[model samples]
Target: MEMNGSNSNLQSDNKQEAVKNPGDETSGSTAQDESWMKLVNLQLLSNELECLICSSLIFDPLTLPCGHSFCRICLTRAFDFALKCPTCRAAVYMDPLSHPTSVALKALTQQLFPE
Candidate 1:
């Protein structure tokens, strides 16, 4: 009798392939898990961006006219004699700050920089 191909070798190859790429079910579960984690991270960021001072989501957040906003009062305290936005190094007057905050941006930030 002569063996044209080694049965053990074929079996080994199959096993290796399977290990490299698991079945559809396993791959699907991994994908689902990744999606779930992404969503959770988004939620966390949303919660965080909610202004700690206002206890509400930041809206038209002033760039501190000092680049930092704090529910109005926070910005006022951060203000220096020159009246410059602390964060952006921009000049600001007594004028109120205003800028739009986006839910999408918050989510993206969470996704890109997951803690």
Candidate 2:
């Protein structure tokens, strides 16, 4: 059975070669998709978190009592004309001029869109 022995040895060598050079193997695409999805998710977050008035990535983000958010400077300038939530148009004349900064969202923006 010399031929059979030679065939087995050839098969073993092929298996060893495949194991040594695994980078040529085709892996599942989930890893690639995951990276792509991460980029898309970051883009979506950047879009959603942008200031509605300035249409830019939010800086010094402040949240109104009505849950609308804007940059602190934008809100102040808008209030000079009319005191209302820029997005929702909820009257905020009675509320304090100084709104609380959205700590979490601001931190996230800083992380995603760093200088």
lDDT of 1 by residue, 14-113 (tens): 7677667776553334777779989998778777655554666554344343334444545555554446665565776565444344445445445655
Give the C-alpha lDDT of model 1.
Answer: 0.56
**Tens digit per residue, CA lDDT, model 2, 43-95:** 89988998998999988988888887888888888888788887888898543
- Candidate 1: misplaced stretches above 4 Å? 1-24, 28-40, 43-60, 64-70, 97-115
TM-score list, all predictions: 0.37, 0.67
lDDT of 2 at 30: 57
Model 2: lDDT to the true structure: 0.81
The TM-score of candidate 1 is 0.37
Off by over 4 Å in 2: 1-30, 94-97
Model 2: lDDT of residue 49 = 91
Q: What is the lDDT of residue 31 in candidate 1?
A: 72
Ten contiguous residues with the weakest lDDT in model 2? 21-30
